[model samples]
Target: MELHIVIEGKKDLGGQLYRQLSDSIRSGRLADGQQLPPSRLLAEQLGLSRKTVSNVYTRLTQERLVLGQVGKGSFVSAPAEAKPRRQLAINLASAAIVAKWDSMHTPLRAPFPEERSRYEFVGGCVTPALFPIDEWRRCMLHGLRQDVKGSGMYRQAEGIAELRAAIAHHAAFARGVVCTANNVVVTNGAQQALDLLGRVLLEPGCVVAVEEPGYPAARMLFASQGARVVGIGIDQEGMLVEQIPQGTRLIYTTPAHQFPLGMQMSVARREALLARALAIGAIIIEDDYDSEFRYDGRPTDSLQSMDRHGVVAFVGSFSKVMLPELRLGYAVLPEAILNAALTVKHLNDWHTATASQHALAKFIADGYLSRHIRRCGATYATRRERLQTLFADVLSPWFELVPASAGFHLAALCKKPLDLDLLLRLARRADVGLHPLSNFYASTPPRAGLFLGYGGIETLDIEIALLRVRDILLQME
Candidate 1:
């Protein structure tokens, strides 16, 4: 690799090179046993004499920072004590804003590979084994080939024409979402869709109602934009529409399946929410993140499909169903805010990646997306069933499973008062990762429970993991 060393005015090239090389070696930026660039090549690149570069290398060898071989080039030596460079503290002009950001909570963080347990029950993650890697690779190659014919200019802010149409058709067929190609705006993910909607629809101090014990990312996102985010409580139906303030400008709901606590919003509640949003002149963001994996009950119409007055903005993501790293999602916007949303999308990041859009468009058009969903859905269903059985038969003493008809995860409320934090700590010690229901709540008093996600872990693993959890509970008693 070429070394990045700057020589100023040719006054002290040796000193500059020596200091940078030593710092890099000590800091471990240059890993131990990594080959250094040829002295002649580095000298040419740095506009320095070969002799000067050799002298610097000789000095580095003397200091034992690099090892010089006769025929081979010098290599970085393992430092005695590799120390990370200390970060300099600087006062910022936007210190208050930075502090506010620091105070916000991030709830959607996934564990690193090293941090993953043998039985991880983390939500919003899909099993990689279920994805059709070969098919997806073909689509990606096709996308790359298609891009070779492009004009090499920035594409439309609304996204590529093919993807917009594909998403519109897919949403219509699968979820009964009412939309055309013109109504769609491809986004980086559902989070970006929410961010764009917040930018277009929200103002400082405006009231934004979100489901309490909700997706924290959405709540915090609206709050970050200076909106007064109010957490409306959820019951068996959904968010309490009656509790939403009259002056609310936006309402975020996961109607298909409530986040953390799994329950579909009843038709009565859905109608009430629509009426309330219409009356208050507010927009409703229906985040249908993972409703495709329905295990039971008939298919329900999306809130967007039921919308008559263009007050609902339907948001959906491929992250939950396919892979989160894809970062592909789209919004079926109302005519009122469609242009504004497109403008915001353009200003945000121009558009979602063209290659990804192309790949997903082909994935949908060629019927691979639906096939993949069905295949994964079956796997998830088996896992969900095993979890339900374990919760009902083996783990019923301390927990009661929430009645949920869809989604890959289920929430179970504690049957009796117990130290949930202690339970979680013990579970972690037993190599069973779990999520607390309390972490999802913002304003209202949180319920003591756990979210058991079946998407990442296998069906057999679910039985073993929860049995471990049962043992932990019994030991605690």
Candidate 2:
């Protein structure tokens, strides 16, 4: 066999070797029938110690992965030709319970990028550089230092009292939302918040009004509950409220800047939606997901703030303000539905993690959160401007740049019919990431658009990326 590979020893020696060998197997670089070189000779050739090679081979062989013969040399074992060749698959047939629905098992959790970058413009992530990491870390350490003996104990079902109060105060002040700590419930993230809300609000066969192209997590939750999810079209002004059904339990919306198709709901449409919801006794989920990054002169007051009747559940998150991994988001419920939701929250994970909640509360209360957002918002503003400048110069005249009055991402409407998945693959080969517009839809996919998040990309790099995208689009056209 022939080999062509280079290994870098940056951090951990064992981990580097493990990753290199793991990748070789996964990518089929070392084929099923391939043979490894003798440990001493291979170690000499690769500038590695013979002990290291012997250890690697011994560990792999002890696991029954490779075959070793006394007279004959060791050889790579061929993986069984089954759908999934892992040990679990071999024992699955002998298991106690019947797994009738086995075809759709997902092998992993949420999709993660194959590579890491300081400038990942992921669909929904903030650049860590913008987060007050030092300040937040110090607060976390301090909180732990000052923590009581019961700090590791289960928290109150209502959530960490300080966090709820801080979230309530910040929401009322910044998003024009009105709620008290009693009305607020901390969640793992906006995703879990949606799932919990769906459990409380939706019946198995209930009718729900969802935006045609909306948040994927919400859509999945609604569908999983067997709710009839109806798609409402969006224009420049946001979700057209006219298509909604009367007496519906929920009307999900990202009012500030709609996801994928970034456009704020017009004042008229906002009024119309609230009036309709009030008339039908339906509650509106006012998803103000990314209102903090409003690029326009003045941010509009939220729909929940304007609710005279209790029709809006305002959801806010620190995920946008901080990091995605820190699952901190809150739902400001009206008193009418507060007790019901809290009861469900109490049962569902008992309560949020106390330490994280305490640390986050201090992060916000100490004014670090606001400062980080202000600094990052300005940085994103420059990046957005650079993207706009590049698009104007190179993108086809027919391509439309939809109004993204607020948020890190905006939609780029394509004039031609193109496969978003195929285009995304091509862009990845060019060392770029894209958020396809189709992935947002429940049904009735949009013709073509790209959800370009200008999250943490350096302004200089964005210009070059946009140029590459422009060139790619032109060739595709």
Top candidate, metric lDDT? 1
* TM-score of each model, paired residue for residue: 0.96, 0.77
Candidate 1, residues 1-477, lDDT tens digits: the string is 556777788688889888988988999888999899998999999999999999999999998999988898799996879887889999989999889888877866766888778899988889998899998999998888878888889999999999999999989988999889999999999999999999999999999999998999999999989999999999999899999998999999999999979899989999999999999999999999999989888877899999999999999999988999999998999999999998899888998888888899999999999999999989888888888899899899999999888889999999999899999889988999988888898887889999888888987888888999999999999
Please give, for residues 1-477, the per-residue lDDT of candidate 2 as tens digits.
Answer: 534435567445545555566556545556665677777777777677788777777766775455676666566664453132244346566454344233323311245656543334566667776777789888888667645645466777778788899998899888878788988999988777787778888898787888888876676668678788888888877788889876588889998989768888888889999998888888889888888987776677899988899889888888887888888888988878888888888889998777788888898899988888899889888888877776676775536678787888878887766666776766777877776677776578465877787775777888667666667766776
lDDT of each: 0.91, 0.76
In terms of TM-score, which candidate is strongest?
1
List candidate 2 segments past 4 Å from native.
Answer: 1-110, 115-120, 149-152, 417-422
What residue runs in model 1 are displaced by over 4 Å at the alpha carbon?
A: 69-72
Indicate the residue-level lDDT of 41 in model 1.
95
